[model samples]
Target: MGMTLVRSLFLIIHQKMSTSSSAILTPVGVRGMNVLDRAKFLRNIKIPVLKVADEKLSKITPICKQYFLKLENFKPVQSVSGEKLKCIHMNPEKIGAWTDLSEIDRKSLKEHSVNEDNFIMKDIELSYENWSYGTIFKAVLPENEDIVSGFTQVGHIIHLNLKDHLLQYRPLIGQVLVNKIKSCRTVVNKSSTIDNTYRNFNMEVIAGEENFLVTVKENLCNFTFDFSKVYWNSRLGQEHERILNFLKPGDVLFDVFCGVGPFAIPAVKKKCKVYANDLNPDSFKWLNHNAKTNKLNMALFKSYNLDGKDFILTVFKEYITNYCLGKEKLEKGAKIHVTMNLPAIAVEFLKCYKGLIEDEELLEKFDCEIIVYVYCFAAGTDVLAVAKSMVIDNIGCDISDNIIDIFDVRNVSPKKEMIRVGFKLGKEVIFSAKDCVSEPPKKKLCVDN
Candidate 1:
């Protein structure tokens, strides 16, 4: 009323702005959870707009275009009066009320007969769709509480590690993710820490499809396995590629504690004879399936279900029988590489390698060099030094001189690293350098048909 009917127009807009339901709060659903009430997540804001008559829109638009609302995917031209009048949104950042306009602004707009009646409130609705994921997610959550920040993708699955405080909102978080992320077909939250023996963790499907069988492609090889039953870390793709880089055609690979052959299948494709094994029966099953799925020669890709130490000995037992005893000299250009990847306690399996074989005359018959890569978790200011000492203590041999290289793979957590301790296995280590078992364990060692 202060600036005639035009000022009254804004007062009328604020009165009815609270009732505007601008867009759909699209809900998502899964088996055990209710649909998310996205309306609760949307924040209401009313920005002023300049109402233009259909006849005058073209003439007024160009002059007032700079003041138009500039939100992503939002149409600056809209109808908000419950009447279908095409109006131009004015940025709240630019002006909040009629008094906010400069004298120059008033004179320019009035030249085209636009006044306070033209200055009406446009109800602005914002949802998670309006901003970045973190922005909207934080907006929905209570202030100062932990935000569920990120997730790992395995095939079509989104794997989340939720903290205790965020556990109650897991369903809502899962639904929001499945709705927002295009590639996500399923969402799972880790239910507990990893089972130390199998390396697989318990998980609950929070949203979308319920399948846990996933197919992942790495180093140009396709590997399929039950993600819930076996352990697979997509973050270790680079580590897999690094090990592959060391192999050549016709080399022999012993992947002790291998989980579904992320390394073994690819090594066989490179013409290396791969002896892959896992303690977990489920992992052993899929390892066989993936090797066949990738079409590796069954003769070249040998799979076994045995503990880490027994698997190590079995591989060497097969190697001696097939490559050393009958043959006059070992394959000239070939090398024997053993990879023990159970980082939680793999270095201890080095005991199986110390004095692995004791026939001195037979050892002299083997000419190929033996190398072992042991993965372990160690923490200290000097990670490499700590890892080296750990290896020395477990293998029970002075391998300081025979050590090839110690590689820092990645950080498992704060101050903890997944380190690779690689070294040449001297005949001393394998032929009783230290006082270890002089005889191999009596177990089934073979080339299974």
Candidate 2:
């Protein structure tokens, strides 16, 4: 029988699977299978597809398997439900194509005439067609304007701003002006070269001050933290908010890369102690300023450059692993949780702890979960190629292969593709201890011949 048939039969018999051991590769035939087709097949079946009838399949099924089902309903609590908006990219100049007056779509288009002047299309000719589009132009809100009404009529966002060209984008234009106004208010507002480019405005660019701002609140039970300084406000700031929203009262947080104390201060305000660590000398200066400015009980700020390898191993050993033959320390209390936002560079760091994890007794320590937000770049190649290569290279690691499909991938830079890989590690040292382990699957994966 085919592997898919065998696996399907196995699942029908077994309800649960051990997620740690066993060959878990999805058979090639099943890999490209469409969910809709599977659903259709499932509907016609009398027995639930999950109800299998084979003994051997049951033995191996649980070795490396877990399943999750989601039911969504519109409610206040469901606000965070990941509902995606569908879009189509239509060229304004090509509106006549298939847009006959008799067509209902053409009538809708006539009723809602979008302003082409407001739309931005570079050298490309503006044409209208049923092309996929994903993004809406929300109006730029000035500080005093009500943010809800700030958005103007719906206009399809055709293109995103390049890093260098962001100054032209309305949102970034406002942000840049605001930043410029703030910098001009500083005492030393004068032209100076910062990182090769000369700045026209003057500000005390202390360790962290340039990257962070200090603001105090009145009658506030707890300090409020803001991450307005980050260069990429929309993407990174959204991520920062997601992490902060998870905080609770008295929950100690350690932001290893506590750049402007975004995570640290918020945790502290919630009556939780925080340990903020960052190697950037500039970051600490602002971190201290913001803590004192907000009148928050300043938490510890460790300013040493944590060698990435050392930091990862330290986490794996102290916070993660426990039960090692010579070492047995529970990562309880405040130390139980740690935050590391640097996923792009974390793979390199995982190398150091390869040996310590091999000891099973110590493996249980790592049972504590990690919320890693990995960022990857395709480096101008196809995204599938990059993703497949990453999976094959990081072999033996107990990552949820299916979990990778849950990311919100976007083309941040033309030549760079971004993907976030988040997973919970098992209590087993899956890393190979052999030094100079040859790289796995370095070449691009070309699925289509």
User: Which candidate's lDDT is highest?
Assistant: 1
**Candidate 1 lDDT by residue in tens digits, 180-251:** 766678999974457446777778899999999889888888889898888887768889999999999878
User: Which one is best on TM-score?
Assistant: 1
What is the TM-score of each predicted model, taking all chains together?
Answer: 0.73, 0.41
Give the C-alpha miss distance for residue 430 in model 1, angstroms: 0.2
The segments of candidate 1 whose C-alpha lies over 4 angstroms from its true place after superposition are 1-35, 46-123, 145-150, 328-331, 433-449
Candidate 2 per-residue lDDT over residues 105-185, each given as its tens digit: 334333344222212222221111111010011112121221121111001101111222222233332222233222221
lDDT (0 to 1) per candidate? 0.72, 0.34
Q: What's the distance in Å from true for residue 308, model 2?
A: 2.6
Per-residue error (Å), model 1, residue 393? 0.8
Worst 10 residues of 2 by lDDT: 128-137
